[model samples]
Target: MNPSHPATASRHTATKTILFVVLAVALLVSVLVSAGTGQLGIPPQEVLGSLLHRVGIDWLPLPTHPTGDQTLWAIRFPRVAMAALVGAGLAVAGLIMQAIFGNPLAEPGVIGISSGAAVGAGLAIVFGLTVFGEWTTAVFAFVAGLAATLIVYAMSRAEGKTEVVTLVLTGIAVNAIAGAAIALLTFLGDTQSREQIVFWQLGSLAGSRWSQVLIVAPVIAIGLIVAYAVARKLDLLSLGERNARHLGVNVEALRIGMIFIVALLTGAAVAFAGIIAFVGLVIPHLMRMILGPAHLPLVTASALGGALLLTLADLGARTIVPMADMPIGMLTALVGGPFFFWLLRRTRKRAGGWG
Candidate 1:
């Protein structure tokens, strides 16, 4: 039950505010640091100055370095923006999945969408298809991801309802199939195609452009807006399916809408950034653990946490090896694997294991 006492209500509100402020500040700091820490090494002051200058708040001077403005506008800004958008989109997508499924373990990556998108991307690379010009891979990923989600949703439904265990199992099977498809594509490809496929599967933001960011942004924004609009319904959902229905929520409609939203968000993220793992899974779960089960604040907190994480990770990916780029999926997995184990232990201990 929600805390209705004035003191308890006030406390919850205060905590939510503090969390929002902290995460927002952290995300801002991470973005600035990432912008400044690249090869040309513009200082944070210069990064801020450049941004302010661009926006017509030109009190501060631009970067002193000759190529600073060019690099920031041409390269760093777009990549940083993409990372933030992808991170927030994936995190919110995971939140919706976990909410609808009532399963902490649910995420786009774990539930086969990411792998399905990978299959599409592999096919595009191996066959050298460019039906949509620069958008071929992204379009293919989105379509395949939507198809995979539909397949999982259709196959998992039994007695007009999707059981938690059944949905997860179906997802695993689908992921396995997608994995094999990727492998076959890899085998068919020559050296260049194989290398492209491998790097794409690994995930990176090395060459992000403003055009790609513009394409991804609107899709993610639509998903987030829809998710936020249904936050209260999701809170009812967390109470249980029967309870949600009793409270006048159209549980079926909500589930279907959120599933599509998840596919949309996942497609946008993976289309340009490739299959980044666990931003969706870890961020939502962590925020829920910290902020209680309130969906309104949880959604925003998770978005900020995810944005901060990916922004920093992108920075690390660039600087960790001096000049070589690192795969984002590997770094996120390194962090998420340990957290997932801990989450399992905590959940089991708290609930006496899953029902």
Candidate 2:
């Protein structure tokens, strides 16, 4: 088939529309179902009712259980909200990185932003630091993550250009150092703190609260807004840096700005959600495969896809083991690990081996 055939165009369009509809519907259903699921098990009606009631709809019936309202407000809702936010943020960050770098595999974690965020958040947890009060962990994570990005940018620059290979290797080196730091902090921390660090590194949304939600929501929102605003530029950048520059794009400024946004989104997310990896790495590629490389659709579809994936993953984490809340990160890693290997092989094949 000719690549530019009208039938092919219409098929891709049809597929994108179907994917958008499916993802949106799935996300809505997942959120509602997850709200009703748990130890107490509220019905879906009550979940929808509670949502509408909060917005002043009194006709729908609420949960009958004595503690249902409290559980929904305090525990279930916050966890689900965090899962959606963190997943969407990471996926958008991943898409942004890939767009700016012009590499299908580019991701926040690939450049050590997640590891840096982990190190910063680990410091806050172990030391019980709260200088920024509720924002301490997030602030620290952003700073350190930005620092990590700077390190990669500096180390990988060769006469004003950064080679992908050098940037990735430098990021790996930074990640190793951060890992060692995390281990040292674990050793020095109290037993309680050590346990917190361990659980955090593994990633769980077990104890999320409204206050934390309030903190992370705006950070991700800001990144998403900026990312969408620059979507056209991202598309232009994909046509090669020199070409983008000739086409009136400030390639350097766009790269740096997008990198900063990635750090902000990734840092804020991992600050609260712990080290959830591969959502960033996987969602964008999957979206690209289905929706094509247009950054605008990629942004919207990737957000929905990431939110749906994480919400379902969180549901499985709690329900899969009887009376056990398996770490959410473990579940994502299960899916991502194999996908990563397959992606690596495909990427290498297309590039005719790594340069």
Candidate 3:
């Protein structure tokens, strides 16, 4: 018997709409608030005026100094925007990967896509491949991530069906191999290249620019829409492969499409921001805990929550010490690692009937 009834469906829909609105407002406030923060400590009114001035609000007085105005317009805005985009993209990618593989534990980091992107970025740094303008590293990173996902998909396929456990195991193996490849690349890199590679590995949004935001924003938007479009199908997919196929879903096609989109989003995020882990794993699971397993709500909640979490984390990264910017990745891992272990313990307890 289906657990979903008409009342439950209506309630779920209502909850989702409310969550979306709340998150939308929250995101707007976060953007404005985060923009005003940093070492310079621009006043909120000034931040608003500068932002409005940029968009043709001539009546409002602008920041008189070029340095302050440029700091807000050029430096802070792009970093916050990139952080939001990367967080949303990685979270959605994780949701898609989990749905496609039918494993709650599956994530871009777990399956090696982030590592692949890092390798791609490292290769570009080491070799100076600049055929594609400023996007040389990004393009290669996307390609490598896509390739890694496809290889894992192929390896996990057996007798024309995907085994979720096998897929996860395949990811572990691929991730290890990708890790080695990255290490090897680092070993062979020159000192200058090695420093660049180290920074990329550690992950920071401190130097993000408008150009990087422009490159990543569109792709992530497209990927998010595609993922949401299939949200209902992903809900059905949670039932079982046989059940999903019986319900008129194209299982194989769905899996492949999800892998592709997730790879694109994950690769683009890693390209611009480097490998930040557990946003995907932690946020989606938190959403699930609060809102249940409906994909529509889950995806939107994950996006908003992930964006908020990363923005806050980035803020901490910048302000945690005076004049010392810590790696954003380190901050995320510091929090996400313990959370993940707690989740594992909780799962084990529940499974053992001790919850």
lDDT (Cα, tens digit) per residue for candidate 3, span 126-184: 99899898989988898899899888878877786666557667878987888888888
Give the clashing pairs for model 3: none
Clashing pairs in 1: none
Off by over 4 Å in 1: 1-4, 154-165
Q: Give lDDT tens digits, candidate 2, residues 1-355.
A: 6867988889888998999999999998899899899889999888989899999998778999999988999999999999999999999999998887667666777778888888888899888999999889889999888888888877877765566678678978988998999999899999998997887679899999999999899998998899889999999888888888999999889988988999999998888888888898899999998788889889999898889989999999999998999999899989987997898799789888867
Candidate structures ordered by TM-score, highest first: 2, 1, 3
Q: Ten residues in a row with the worst lDDT in model 3? A: 346-355
Tens-digit per-residue lDDT, 27-90, candidate 1: 9988989998866898888899999998799888799999999999999999999999999999
TM-score of 2: 0.94
Name the candidate that leads on lDDT: 2
lDDT of each: 0.88, 0.88, 0.84
lDDT of 1: 0.88
- Model 3 whole-model lDDT (C-alpha atoms): 0.84
Question: TM-score, each model?
Answer: 0.94, 0.94, 0.89
How many residue pairs in model 1 have overlapping backbones?
Answer: 0
Q: Output the lDDT of residue 341, model 2.
A: 80
Looking at model 2, the pairs that clash are none
